[model samples]
Target: MEVVALVSGGKDSCMSMLEWGNDTMGTDELDSFMFQTVGHTVLQSYAQCMGLPLFRHTIRGKALNQDLHYAKTQEDEVESLYVLLKEVKKRFPNVQGVASGAILSDYQRFRVENVCERLGLVSLAYLWQRDQKELLQEMTEVPIDAVLIKVAALGLDPYKHLGKSITALRPLLFRLSDEYGCHPCGEGGEYETLTLDCPLFRYKIVLDETEVVIHSDDQFAQVGYFQIAKHHLEPKADYDASLVSGGEGIVYDVWKELPDELPQCTEAEVAVDAASTTHGELQAAEPLDISLSHGAQAKCRGGEHRRVAAGPTLCRHKG
Candidate 1:
């Protein structure tokens, strides 16, 4: 079961795939209501660093319908995923599901699940509903090199914390969680992260210079964005990808509480790739007009971005 991973160049998205230990075959189309466009300009570097092809689709719709249960509508953001996945499926026919890093967003989960169901793809939400502290522990334990790019919390200072790795901010995060009721895992939009290097990365992204753009300078909550100005990819020594975090990829059937539309996936047949284009009505939909796209494909070569290491919490549905 090859899966098309949905990456936003963030920690959870990176970690979600890490949890499954699957190599992402592709990624990114900047700017959408559903995805983080910040640091999106460098998203292709992820695919490049991992030696995988990158697919893209410009989002042309807004979050028109915010219902807990998603139903497609014309000019809606959810439809963009539907179309993008359809195109991915068209390109990579072996893809069986999508990998997401969603931990607490039912809004996001429903929309993604909706798209997967329509296209016969499984929603591999490995981090769904997991304990936040544990998730953070696992991310840092596996040690994803990630930094805060955006901060919007009462205790967090974006200018001070921007470009700082999450590992370095753990104590502060825990302190803030106790003092200000902040989300330790940032599930509450307190901040957003960009993974500079992870097990999935073939090379590490190094920042030479940066410009911090302040969105809000409030006393309680200061919102700032890191406009990464100078960066380059530096090659790293190869190591065993599977042993990075002892994570195996998530499969659809491994989930207990799942919708009936999702197929019964087997470990023997579950893996993640990028791209899904099987929406019946979306088949003829016009392609989004965007130039931030790439289509080169690469097979995993040991150290290449490839294969999943399933985590410890796999649950199977009773047949």
Candidate 2:
């Protein structure tokens, strides 16, 4: 069915689009619609990359006020969104359903349902209350570029959110949920994200202008950044330098700096403990050390070492 998906550039929205994939060619169902509330440029970049037909609504007045105030309930939040969806429904006369990225939010679901009822549009929320840890792990396995656009919760260095890959952040996210009260996927407004490249997008987004926001106080050390501009995606034989890291067609030799053997007690293990970190932060900054009778040995996974003890203190691994 042709549908208008309310995409937030988050995992749930992106994954909802992927659900349209069909077993056979030419049988794919669902036409996607993306709307950007505040980040129009980011959405535009995404549309150009994914080649999707998008409808943009400029958010202002009451809606903008509510967002600025960080309104907690959906009543205030959806007042503006409802108006936007109404306009979108008219554009797609054949739309049978409206898609959303809502997960674990009754307010979000109820609001979407209310809007759909008014427009005779079906509400599709594929992800709601799924195991966040599993959901996040699945995201890492998927082909997508999830980057942090906003981080307001405790323990999240706004700096870490910017330009960080979702895969690299998964372990950290798990730790945050276990150790701190922060939501694992930022489902509770701990942070926000934008997917730069994905299967749904035809082109990849490349950031051209970005500025970091620094909030300095005696209590916190953090940075936040936003994309001001990005490359205009157009057909070209060669990839743009600003878009591709390490440049297009450039080969990376991974073996260039790899070590043959790691000094060790032998095998290495990852506990995968969410409790070790909070808000995507590893609790302990110190590395695990292997203490010996004569001395102590601290060796990183890649073989970097510091000898805390004097005697024959072999590392956790030999490199």
Candidate 3:
């Protein structure tokens, strides 16, 4: 089936296109479509990088008022997309389905499906219902070069992380997910991403400069975004493909060997470990601490100091 991909210059959209391409290879011709929303025509660069013909439409209206409940409040946005697809259909009459990057947002998926239904186009949401964590890991494994462009959630430092690749932020993102219930793939509007490079891209986008725009700052959370000051697409042949293909094999190996049931550590075990050492006992043990600056002395059970050389050391002494 020939389809039009709905791109937003983001990781999810780009990754969806790559997956759709992989799935429909030899059977479908992929074209791209996008609505010029807040980010302007930056997505056009992405479409160009992918070497896909793009159909773009500018959305003209007051910003859709986000309601307390998720309904058809954003119908205007969908309508804009509807208009864009009609134009796409006029250009590519064989287009049968519309590709969407929706993962967990029913609001987004429903709106796109509604428009597709009206236009007699099938909505292809390949990323829908996939495990978020696994999806994130796969994204990195595919070596998708996506950077955080906007952030508005707790536990995220947009200043530090803005424009950093998703691969670099994987561990931090998972940590936030585990500790603070952050969406693993930013599905909860915690952040937004822009794809710089992917397998589908013929060229890779390089940022020459960017400006950090901060919207809010507080003790608990900071909200900010990156504005592209300068950017250009570089020929893929200019870089070493091996370095660009970072840890793809390692990620695949780890994912494939993952167990159905992951190991669980009980809270009781944690409490028992904590209870093993009282405050006073811990204070006493602190004095036996080995100075990490110099070669540390390991205190044995017999109270003998054994000199040990250290570049990096992990010392655990039981009293």
Candidate 4:
């Protein structure tokens, strides 16, 4: 049976892909699917590296405001996922099943299942209810090169997250889970991730460029902001997760934080060309150090201006 896995370049999604090769479903066959979001380049690149036939469904982050405020109610989730499923149906006309990397969030699972029921797309939760600790261990064992992209939890700071390697983050996540009740793999939305290089990827994603943007909230003490970056894939020279750990990316802060609607970036101008050479090697690269901004750009330590038009302004910050 042709299937599409809702990949996020996280442990669960990678596990789902690896599971496809195993003869668990006997005669049932497998295919791959990915849900693309603007900030999730690592996962998208991972899918390309793996040579998976991917169908991307775009969802505006702002559209999730209602769900975020209302706790992802059934109606909210169903409506959102319905849009995604409809797009998937158009691409894979005969898709028999839709796989997810869902682990413990019943809210997330229920929503996906509802979409599948509506579209006649079987819902497969391969990583549901498994031991959280064990799952983290497996992620390390498989050694997926994932990095934390956003952090909204107590124990995790933007510094702890932005450019840290997944393996480095694991022990801290484990400690957070043990002490502060944080979800081990951030299932509770404490954080989110992006996979750069994984076993399933055909080529490693190399991040060539980046910029920082703020998404602040009045209600929260620590406002939310993220580093946006561009990635490209290239053939693997030698498979080593640690080699790519150094290029984990950068972080910047929000100044004069307000609760206004976050601004969007100018659309990425680069096109994906299969023949593109590795733009920058990931081996032994350094994490980007950027200062907070009050107006249009973030000041980077390297003396280069990282532009952020109407997104975040650097005004008085010095580079």
Candidate 5:
């Protein structure tokens, strides 16, 4: 099915797209309650890199209702998604689904699924409720080439850490997770990443200019973000072309810098007690037909007999 990708210029979202493994008809760049919009200035380049059409919209609604199950309202931000997706469906009639990068946030997952239901589209989230540390390691190994664009956690130096690549910062991130109780995958908003390149890209995104804007200067934890002033896509040769075939022709001699012993990643998901909201009692998401088998990837087959219900069931795993 031709699904529309929901990109937010972040690592998890990009990885989710990679996990999609389907033909993405296009991409929608949104600034909403669920999106990390700090690097939205360079988001347009993502379409160029992925060779897809770009659809963009600024959310015009506020978080008037903060609940687990969302009801349709004109004044809420989820409605803005509804509006944008409605336009997408109107323009691309064959588009059957919407893809998102929801990890642990039940609030975001339910809201997006709510909009998909209203629009009669499937909601695809390949990275829901995965262990944070394992997810982080997989992201780094995926070689997403993501960088820190925002840092708002303790023990992270805003001035010193901003704009550093995730591959280079993995050690520090894990250490901080052990000592400072930081979320290794940035699930708790300790930091945010902006993906620069991925295997799916036809070109590489390069940051030409940027400026760090500090939101807070507290001694312990500093809140900061970067404004991407200018960026351009570097043309990359297609590996299927005459110059290369069957593999990436570019070679790297990595034995010199490689460590002989593989490091064991024991980082687990940080547990946070979620209390009932005073706003209202929450409703649990409808149980999905998909399996949550450990160390196994559950795929949704395209058989006519296999139909994923269009509600708050968000997990669509890899092969």
Candidate 6:
């Protein structure tokens, strides 16, 4: 069934496309629909990286009111999406499904599903009802290199976390999830992410320059977004064909084997492990290989090495 993926250039939207493309009936050759909301302009680069045809329509009414409440208050925004989907239908002619990345937002899910119902398209929310923490870990396990472009939560430091990779923010996310009840996946407007590279991309995006905008700052909460000044898509010479050629990609598996209680280690142990590696040899080799365990080995790509531990633990180092 041909589908139209709703994307916002955020982690959930991008990851939802990756999840949908894993299904037997889905493929990389799918149409994408995006609402031209506040951050919608940056999605063009994201769509380019994925090599998908995008259909965009700017929301005619106020994009986001100062205060947003549930119910029909945002119905006008939904209508904008509905109009875009109709255009996608006109172009594709065979689009039967509308894919969404709603993890826990019933407000978003209900509205999108309502629109699809009127249009006779199935609403496919593959990421629905999944654990947010596990979902985030799964995202990092794959090649989804997302960076925080906006933050609006209590615990996150805009200065520290802005433009930091999602992989690097896992610990902070977990802490916020445990202490402050913040959604680990940022499903509740806690943060927003921009995917730089993923298995679905034909080219990788490199941000050339960015300006940080701080809308509000106080002790309780900090809100901000990164304005991309310039960026370009770099070609991926070793692009994995199997990712889009009907075979299972790196993100195909759902981490069901994740341990209930992951093993804990101290900072001293991590420092010791880091110090043990031969830095001189690593710098000299072109394609360095480092064995992490009996079955796991780290491979150097583009002078970088990412070591994956046994159970959803990642340790990255630059050579």
Which candidate achieves the best lDDT against the true structure? 5
Better of 1 and 5 by lDDT: 5
Model 5, position 255: C-alpha lDDT score: 21
C-alpha local distance difference test of each model: 0.61, 0.45, 0.52, 0.46, 0.62, 0.53
**lDDT, model 4, position 77:** 18
Clashing residue pairs in candidate 3 are none
| lDDT over C-alpha atoms for residue 203 of model 5 | 74
RMSD of 3: 23.2
Name the lDDT value of residue 51 in candidate 2: 35
Show model 6 residue runs off by greater than 4 Å: 22-39, 62-75, 244-319
C-alpha RMSD for every candidate: 12.1, 22.2, 23.2, 18.4, 14.1, 18.4
Q: Alpha-carbon error at 203 in model 3, in Å?
A: 0.6
Candidate 2: worst-modelled 10 consecutive residues by lDDT:
23-32
Q: Model 2, 242: alpha-carbon shift in Å?
A: 28
For model 1, residues 153-202, the per-residue Cα lDDT tens digits are: 77777668988888999889988988988778887777778899887766
Q: In model 1, where do residues sit more than 4 Å from their true spots?
A: 28-33, 241-319
Using lDDT, rank the candidates from best to worst: 5, 1, 6, 3, 4, 2
What TM-score would every model get versus the actual structure? 0.75, 0.61, 0.67, 0.60, 0.77, 0.68
Across 216-236, the per-residue lDDT of candidate 2 in tens digits comes to: 322442424344455455443
lDDT of 5 at 214: 72
Q: In model 4, what is the error at residue 91, expressed in angstroms? A: 4.7
TM-score of 6: 0.68
Candidate 4 ranges beyond 4 A from true positions = 22-38, 41-47, 60-80, 83-87, 211-225, 237-319
With a 3 Å backbone cut-off (N, CA, C), the pairs that clash in candidate 5 are: none
Model 1 TM: 0.75
